[model samples]
Each structure stands twice: as C-alpha cells, then as structure tokens.
Target: MEFGAVSDEMEVKAPAAEAWKVYSTLQLAKLVVEMRPDLVEKFEVVEGDGGVGTILKLSFPASTPVFTYSKEKFTVVDEEKRVKEAEVIEGGYLNLGFTLFRVRFEIIEKDEITCITKTTIEYEVKEESAANASFVSTQTFVEIMNAVATYLTTKQL
Candidate 1:
C-alpha cells in the first residue's frame, strides 16, 4: 500500500555540518537527477541565502517504460528540529491519492561525532492510484540512504 513513499535512515561518524555540506551542495541534486535526468534540467536558485524557495524540475526519460513524471521538486537545506518546514513541499501529481503527499530528510546529531539522517515520506494514495503491483519504494529509499552513508564514510569528517 505504501508504494509512493520510500524512506531510509543512516548513521554517520561525522559532525552534522560535515555531512550537511555534501547534502546541501548543489551537486547533490545530480544523484536524484540520474533517476530523472530529463526532469531536473537544473536547479532553480531562489532566496540567494543558500536556503528556501529553490525548485528543481524533475523529468522522465524518453526511453522509460512506465509513465512517470520527469520532474518532482525535492530539496535540501537547513531546517530546525521540530520546527515545521515551509519550503520544499511535494504533492500535485505524485499526490498518491491525497492532495498532500510529502517527502523529507531530517538530520539529527547523536553526539559530537555521530549523526543520523532520517528520510520520511508521506504518500496518501487513493484507490485509483493504489492498484499498482510491483513496488520498489522501500528499496529505492534504502539506496538513497546508502548513498548518504557512502558519502559520509568516504572521509572522517
């Protein structure tokens, strides 16, 4: 039933800021862009403070089989814990079934040298959209998480 949401969590041996830098970098978008290279032609810069209001156009490839969206607006930026996030909202067509589906990555420090990144996705699929059979949501999420793990483990930052 949870075909729309793919989430994973990973622990890192680096400071939050260290890992944050990589995730916050503009290059990070390319990882996801590989899945939908046609969708995100590039990053749309906004706010200018390296925060908020940035949007990416996600596009599907011409050679793909499934009729998927070429673009979805996923984002990376600093956010306060428990403080409601206003930017980087998701929904529209990936709406699952409801008008308010969302995906988010939250990072928290466990200590001076440890941090955990939690990926949360809320997908409210209606009966019409819930009829799909093959599902790789969780696996996709795990892959994303592993990417972060790999990035964080590459160095002892």
Candidate 2:
C-alpha cells in the first residue's frame, strides 16, 4: 500500500544555471548546511559523485529534530532537465515510520536570471508506524529551497 504525494514550487531569483550548479552537485546538503548550520548539524557524502548513485548522510540540529541521521541515494539525475531524484535508502525517516520515501527536485528556467524550483515527495507508511507520519513535513523542503535560493542569489553578485 502507498500514500499520496506532495509537491511544492518556488521561484528563485537566480538563474537556472546557478540553481543547477547547486542541485546537480553532490555538494547540495553541504552547501545548504554551510549557509544554515542552524538547520542542519552536518552533511557527509558517503559515496559517488553528484550524479546518480551518490549517497549522502545528513544530521539535523536538535532544535528541528527529526531523524538525527539519514542516508539518501540519488536514483536519477537529468542535468539537461535540471532534475534530480533521491530515495531514502536507510536511517531517519525510515526508522521513524516511513516504509518508502522519495523526493524529486526540478529546476526550470523561467528567464535568464530566474528559475522555478519544484519538489515532489512520494511516500508510504508502515502499518505500525502510522502515528509517526506526522513527523514528515513537506515544509522542510520549501525551507531548504528558500535557503538554497538565498545562498545562490548572494553568491551570484
């Protein structure tokens, strides 16, 4: 059995190239943490390049605590479309309640200096972990996108 999906979109003030540079690289979690360590305690790349098959381990701050540690692997990377998809292979959300968790990020060019960032989260819950479903929030991705947008815009100037 599977739950529904959630999707969010935000327009960034930076160009598609800049957004792609950040998202298409394995440095995504690192870059975001560097800009906002308050939100993330640490981000480590366990394996692979920014491309498909990359694995990233992430730790969150106690303040916004969820899963202290999470391991994710990139399942898809389409640079030409500026889209990347990752799945939770281990840790964090899975340990909490989710049976399956995956996210897809798409950066679409709106103009020479602007782009739209879209994130879609698809998940399924374990029967025993239904109560823990509340811990999963799509807003987290929106906040991350906002943070990344701010960082990229600042670096562009």
The best candidate in terms of lDDT: 2
Assess each prediction's global lDDT (C-alpha) against the native: 0.52, 0.85
- Candidate 1 — what's its lDDT? 0.52
Worst 10 residues of 2 by lDDT: 129-138
Give the distance in Å from residue 4's predicted Cα in candidate 1 to where it truly belongs.
8.7
Model 1 clash pairs?
A: 39-57, 39-58, 39-59, 58-70, 58-71, 59-70, 59-71, 60-70, 97-125, 97-126
Candidate 1 lDDT tens digits, 1-157? 3345556677877777666665565455665564334433334433343344455444445553444442344344554451112222443344334433455666678888788877666555556666542332455445655666676677554
Worst lDDT 10-window in candidate 1: 82-91
- The C-alpha RMSD in Å for every predicted model, in order, reads 5.0, 1.5
lDDT of 2 by residue, 1-157 (tens): 4385888999999999889888888667887788778767797889987789999888888886666778899999998888999999898778877888999999999999999999999889887877776666678788889889888888878
- Candidate 2 clashing pairs, residues 3+ apart or interchain: none
Off by over 4 Å in 2: none
